[model samples]
Target: MVLRAVAVSRTQEDGGRSELLRGTGVGPVGGLAASGLVLGMQCALLGVGAGTGLLALEGARPADALAYGAAVCGTCALLAAATMLLAQLTTDATGARGAGLAALGLLYAGHGVWAAERWSRAGAWSPFALRGAIDPGGADDWCPLLVAGAALLVLLAVAAAAARGRDLGVGLIRFGLRHRRPLRAGGPVTLALRLSRMQLLAWAVATAAVAGVLTAMGENMVELARRGAVEGGVLGSLLGGSDPGAGLLDYIGVLAGALACAQAVVLVGRFAAEERSELVEAERGTGSGSARLLSAWCLVSLLAAALTLGAAALVSGLVGAALLDTTAGDALRLVAGQWPSAAASAGVTALLGGLWPQARWLAWAPLLGRVA
Candidate 1:
């Protein structure tokens, strides 16, 4: 849902048309609301359809499936409204999207905690309360829909008001233009990193927050360890074999590795976006050389992937050391052990993106299997 909203927002804000709109928009607030409506409607339909179809396939009753779909649709529209507000808060679409991604990760962690700690019976005001929006197994209780619907309305209202007050093509909170000294990037690699600073910051913060949430659930993980699903593997051993509270760490570590690889795949695609936007062609015309420009992103993608896992390992390791009664080294090892996988995924994506750009999505095949 976050991705869908981000994609739609970016499409609506394509660089050139935005400048034109700035001069000509008759009613910025109405236009903003209209665009947000379009985003919400599209996301709502996709969410409902996908949720219903998936639930039906699981043999859920028609009433239950519809209920789940409605919950999903409400959440999707809420996220779209959120993205609209975020887009105004941050100066760039990518930053807004990155912030949205961060929020999504935090919510996912919250959902995990909600389930692990069994907070459903708690009062509506309990912080861990989650509705059927994320945890379908808890769908029998639908009281959360009112909260979600209220949030959606509030977000849309705030977004429209903010739109009315700000000039088009700029954020509500503008960064200072003054600088003490000239800022310069040494090379294409440095430039690429500079441009992606916001995204990297978002990923790091979100990963740490998630790790903290997992650490806080350490006591519950002891009960989870009884399942023994995380036992008996070379990698599993590094995660503390059969230790109390270790099974959940090991399992989530494995999933986090797949996420790291997914990040690599996304980073490699940045070059493709640049190419499609003619940025690469223009840079080549400036004598930057096509090879140098593309190669910069290739190296950046590999480094970014490594940086992600490194950050995850560091945070999760701290969580283990502080709360889980386990050695930090073991937890760090489990989380960071997937560097090779991330590097390989980067190579595959960069290769396919450079060669058969039209079929670059094929690069995602390995990660798909890993995730499944």
Candidate 2:
């Protein structure tokens, strides 16, 4: 009787364990699959949109649209696969997060360098100027210099971040050490502040720099606008028919800033995911609460967007004034003009990150749309 009772207990325990595993596995798999489906659909939609736009502009045939769509889809698929592979290879959370941040910084710096070089070599010529400054030799001379300098800057930043991350044994830029002692005086807000302090600071610095750059660039844009070289149409209407090269650079910077904001959103969302996936439970068992955790995560996301975008604007304004002999006041005004759109994009992304933790796949939509 004793042996039979023990055997029955063991059987029941095994059955319960199996049930638990099966139930738990379903949510993760389903979430991942859903995310994948959303991503693929968004990519397809982007391709279709781009193809349609191209057709409308050129009055291309259906076959032309079809070909363009196919190319876009193929490119999206390849990029998606590459991103997933990179994520998989960096299985360690700290490493993965660090890599993502590094990539954002590198992309921003690279695009900036590209813009500067292109403007310098193209000699204030419009893109449609068929007879102007088509010096292959000038491009060859400058392109390599820009690429090398940008690459070096990116590598240095990555290496520095990686070293710091290794020392901390966490993500390079993330805060919040696993606290051991219980809170005696201050409450959840205090905890959140402590946790997100580093991230907020990083965001502030990045945004300030980006804003400065944008402001500087705007001054130069105003000068170009004064010149009648730029045409007066839809494109001109938006960029004030400024130096086409400068306009292109401004657009690129905006796109890069948007991308960086998106990345920040994803990083914050990952924090929520980690919490939901049992990792946070382990930390909570030690003393953290949901309010403290969520606050810290959200704060980081907001700060990142504000700082990086602000920096882009500032830099553009400063550079525009110095390079194009525009007044500082005018550059500031242009930077101010761009704020609403930039803020809207960043705000929407941050809100999405908070509301839909599992829907990070959606962030890729804007990026894919750009590519298309």
Q: What is the TM-score of each candidate against the true structure?
A: 0.78, 0.51
Task: Please give the distance, in angstroms, between residue 285's alpha carbon in candidate 2 and its true position after superposition.
Answer: 4.1
lDDT of 1 at 366: 97
Cand. 2 Cα-lDDT: 0.46
Q: Could you tell me which 10 consecutive residues in candidate 1 have the lowest summed lDDT?
A: 122-131
Best by TM-score: 1
For model 1, the local distance difference test gives 0.68
Model 1: per-residue Cα lDDT over 2-117, one tens digit each: 65565555435544455556568547676676677777678678667866686756666666665666666776676677777777777656677677777767666766666667
Each prediction's whole-model lDDT (CA): 0.68, 0.46
Q: What's the alpha carbon RMSD for model 1?
A: 4.8
What ranges in model 1 sit over 4 Å off? 11-14, 19-38, 49-59, 110-143, 223-246, 275-282, 356-372
